[model samples]
Target chain A: MSWLIDPFADFVFMQRALLGCIAISLGATPVGVFLLLRRMSLTGDAMAHAILPGAAVGYLVAGLNLGAMTIGGVVAGLIVAVLTGAVARFTALREDASLAAFYLISLALGVLLVSLKGSNVDLMHVLFGTVLALDDAALTLLCAITTFTLVALAMVFRPLVLECADPRFLASVSRWSGPVHFLFLGLVVLNLVAGFQALGTLMAVGIMILPAAAARFWANSIGGMLAVAATVVAVSSVAGLLASFHAGLPSGPAIILAAGTLYLLSLAFGPSGSLAARYWPRAHLEA
Target chain B: MALRIRDLTLGYDRHPAVHHLDLDLAPGSLTAVVGPNGAGKSTLLKGLTGELAPLEGCIDRGVARLAYLPQLSEVDRSFPIAVGAFVAMGLWHRVGAFGRVGGQDAARVAEALAAVGLTGFDKRPISALSGGQVQRVMFARLLLQDADLILLDEPFTALDIKTAADLLAVVQRWHGQGRTVLAVLHDIEAVRRHFPETLLLAREKVAHGATDTVLTAENLFRARQMSEAFDDTANVCVRPATRGAA
Candidate 1:
């Protein structure tokens, strides 16, 4: 208890890191749940990778200026997203294949751009993130991104669900499908940019997708999955931060690894569809 | 409100699936579209619902609100949503994306579920339902839509007899409420039994009139023949001159 209490209480940096993680978890996890529901978990990962080249370009231009990097990342991400969608729509290639092509190219471009100007240490920081060294500016950006995500998500909640569940029905009823989908993509890119500040471009999607995949085992409804995913992310953030502090490990991987462990646990023991529940079945309900 | 479709051509990639179609659906008319597998019964509905833009013509629906039920395959049933919440989506026109679901809305949802024989099953996840139950849930959603015009594509194709009959009753109730209903169906007998008007199509309209007249053997055969005669590599159509054309 003291190990958990003392670090957060005494160290201001630790407090900021924790707050940053919690804020990201609140915003990104719900988006992650929808991503999972839409079967776009890998799309989140692809988009995360897609953010790198823009971020790297920002690094090349302005070094460590937060605004420069954030804008660059967002622009690059939206470009990839739009291009991938267009390729899928206009060509014979499907969305997943197009996405894979774009993300791979984006990743290679990012690595090349980073190496062109910065040393290996700066490159490592960009790839793996510097969670422990979050300044007031970085923290404020994360909070702002989270606030926008929550409000936008609230606004698009019903139509978003309908778009995922029954797109044709939604199209028939309202003309909001295209706008809602693009808005959701914008949210995904924005959250990834925020997570990139805390977890790096490479591991940014880890905090999103892992907890969402884990929540699928524990909950049976969209709202329930969202609640469970947010909880998992929050808990994993605390555990990972504490572990990284104690073991002198890199913070981003530690947080992601914590989320990975929770996913495995949920897969094995969660009440809804876990391996344990499957093997040791409950009695049938009396209808 | 009446719907007038003039020279509608709908398809994928500019290759028309439904071609040179002209139709007039009377207000409160209960109509069934019957044809072979590739006869574009679904395409016409897609055109009407605005899911597919017409390649050649227009549908004038006159500001009527529409509720469309695509084939079950179009819906992602694996999505994690409660039966009640899924059904409540019908109130989208009223509640919209941000509007709250009030107490009366909840009661309306319950009534819809009850109408579809899904009483007290509100909390069940849609993933847990069988094919018949899923169809019922879709019907419940339609009940809540409360639209002036309804379109159903293959609504009873895979449903069990009981489920089909129950759903048919719901469709009839919509007719009783003086709403225009158009359904794409395979069971000619069911269409004859329930729907008063029939439009026999095979990528092109074969006949459009009262069910008994339009569903005759000659019309049905012509529709099948026209469907079978479709050319996969055919170029864009050159329509023959109409009677009044110069």
Candidate 2:
């Protein structure tokens, strides 16, 4: 308990890191649950990589300026998301295939840009992130993004769920399907941008998707899944930060690894639909 | 008329899935759209609901609230939503994105569930339901929609007999309330028995009149032959300048 409690209490950086993680968990996990429900988990992963080039460009232009990097990341991500959707809709290529093509290009371009302008350490920071070193600007940005995400998600909650459940029906009744879908993609990109500050572009989606995938085993409804996912994310963040402080591990990967471990555990033992649950069946419902 | 269309040509990529259709739906008409598999029955419904834009003509729906039920396959059965919440989405037009589901609304959802014979199924997840139960849930949703015009596409394709009968009774109830209803159906016997008007289509309007007259063997055979003769690689339609002059 002392080991777990002392570092965050003593170190300001550790406290900031914890706060950042909590902010991210509050916002990103709900979006992750929707992505999981829409079967767009890989799309989330792709959009994460898609933001790399934008952040790299930002770094190239302003040298780690938070505002520059955030704006650049968001613009780049929106461009990629919109372009991928347009290509899928207009051309014969499927969405996944087009997304794969765009994300691969974006990843290569980001790596090349980062390596061309900065040292190896700088490149690593941009890719894997420096969660423990989050400053005032990054912390404020994280909190603000989380605040906006929560509000926007609430505003669009009903339509977003309807769009996911029955898109054609929503389209027939109201003209909200297209706008709601784009708004959701915007939220995904916004959360990824927020995650990128603390987790890096490469690992940002890990926090968003891993806990959501794990939550599926524990909960049977969307609301339940969201709750379980947010809880998992919060726990993983604390555990990862503590591990990073005690051992010599990188914080972002440490956090993501914690989430991964929980995911595997849930896969095997969660009561809702896990392997253990299947092996030791509960009694059937009276209905 | 509740709805009118003139020279409607709806399609994907301009290939004209439903070609050159002219139609008028009266304020309280209960009509069935029947044809062979490729006769554009679903496409016509899509055109009416504005899901597919017409290529060469227009649909004029004059101030009518519309409710459309697509095929069961269109609904994401695996979505993690409860039956009650799913059915309550029908009130979207009234409640909108941020509106609360008031106590009265909850009662309406309960009544809808009871109407569909799923009275205590409010808390059940949609993924746990059978195909027939899911159809019943969709019907309950339509009941809550309370639209002036209702369109159902293949509402009973794979449903069990009892579920189909129950849903058909719901349709009859809507008709009795003087709401206009149009359904795309493959079952000619059901259409003939329940629907007063029929439209036989084969990428074109082969006939539109009384169910007994339009569903004759000759018209159905013509619809089938027209559908079979459709040119997959055909160019964009070249209708004459004037309707009768063609």
Candidate 3:
């Protein structure tokens, strides 16, 4: 039992890891809600995979400066958005097909760049994540990104959700949905790039989407969903940190697994509207 | 002023759905566009509402402000939005970015809800509402928009008799208040009983004028018969009204 507190107490690194987890979780959850509501979850997945090549390019060009790398990643994300939009407009192909094409190509390009640089280990760290290895710079970047993400969401909460909930109304009134959508995509890209040093490509997106998806099972209002999603994200981040410390596992995967566990729990036993709500109608009566 | 369309042509991606069609909407009147299933009724509404650009010609005295309600079946209802929040969307044009919902906005939302006979359902989740109830919520939203011209596409689809009657009453109320309404409907009797004007469309305008003159057997037969000039995929078929059934 003391061993639990021992890891936390013995090292500043552990404390930083926990903080980093909180930051990434905070930044990504509401973002996930937007992505899910827009039916862009698959697009989010593609963006995550596509960031690998950009990260490699950034690393090669700027030699691990977090800002430069993030810029590179965001540029890649915008390219994905533009390419997907263009393909959908010009061809008979759908958005998903375009995303699949872009991401798969990006994955190949990322591998090739890493091989060219002869930095296989660093490349693995970028892909799989290295949150435990995060220095002071990465920590600062995560904090700043989290702050910016939350503030932007606060500023545009209504229009963003309004656009998703009823685009026809926006169109009738001449509100441009494209810029808002692109801005959202840009923020998601930033969060992905900022979180990569800590959670890696796969885990960062998983953390963003899974907790929000779980939150959907529990709430019927935007505020309620946002609150629930943020809480689930915070709780799962802590659990993942503790589990990773004790069991000698990678922090990112452990955090994702923790979030996945919460999702399953939400799926199974969350109150009235949850999956548990479906099987146990009598259980719902009490809530 | 009357609404006028001058030789308007429209299409999706250069494939013309409405070809050199002209129309005039009399102010303060209710007009129903009755047609076969593919008769370009929706396209006409889209063209009128400025959603689809006219490939040729232009609109004159098109409503300075317009409200459009899409088919109930066309909307995705899974979003977790409240009735009040849904109606509040109409006030987007009035509010500034990042502005809080003030007393006035809230009042407007409440008034819109009351107008639709749903005054107490401000907090009700949209997904929880019945089909007719949902349509009423949309009507409330349109009320909040308060546009001079209202275009509804198949607003009565899947509704019961009472709900449809209640909805038509709401439309009549709008017309009484001097708002112009162009509603796309499939029921011929709903048109005859409720609306004073009608437009019959089949890729092109088959008839446009008084409901009785437009709903004649000759025009009905022409509307049902597919256009021979265009290929099957290129032609827009408006479904013939199942007359007097409603």
lDDT of 2 by residue, A1-287 (tens): 89989999999999999999999889899999999889999999899899999999999999988899899899989988888888988999998999889989988898889888889888888778889999999999999999999999989999899899998788777789878888899999999999988998878899989999999999988888988999899999999999999997999999999999999999999998799899998887995
DockQ for candidate 3, please give it: 0.49
Q: Poorest 10 consecutive residues of model 1 chain A by lDDT?
A: A167-176
Per-residue error for B194 in candidate 2, Å, reads 1.5
Local distance difference test, per candidate? 0.90, 0.89, 0.81
- Where does candidate 1 clash, by residue pair? none
Better of 1 and 3 by TM-score: 1
- Please provide, for model 1 over A1-287, each residue's C-alpha lDDT reduced to its tens digit, 9 standing for 90 to 100: 89989999999999999999999889999999999889999999899999999999999999987889999999999999888888987999998999899999998999899989979999888888889999999999999999999999988899999999988778777888888988898899999999999899889999989999999999888888988998899889999999999999899999999999999999999998899899998898997
Q: Which stretches of candidate 1 lie over 4 Å from their true place?
A: B227-229, B232-236, B241-246
Candidate 3 structure quality by residue, lDDT tens digits, A160-249? 877788776665675656667667877888888877878887777887789888888888888888899999988888788888888888
TM-score chain B for all models.
0.94, 0.94, 0.86
Highest-lDDT candidate: 1
The residue pairs in collision within model 2 are none
Provide per-model DockQ scores: 0.80, 0.79, 0.49
- Between prediction 2 and prediction 3, which has the larger lDDT? 2
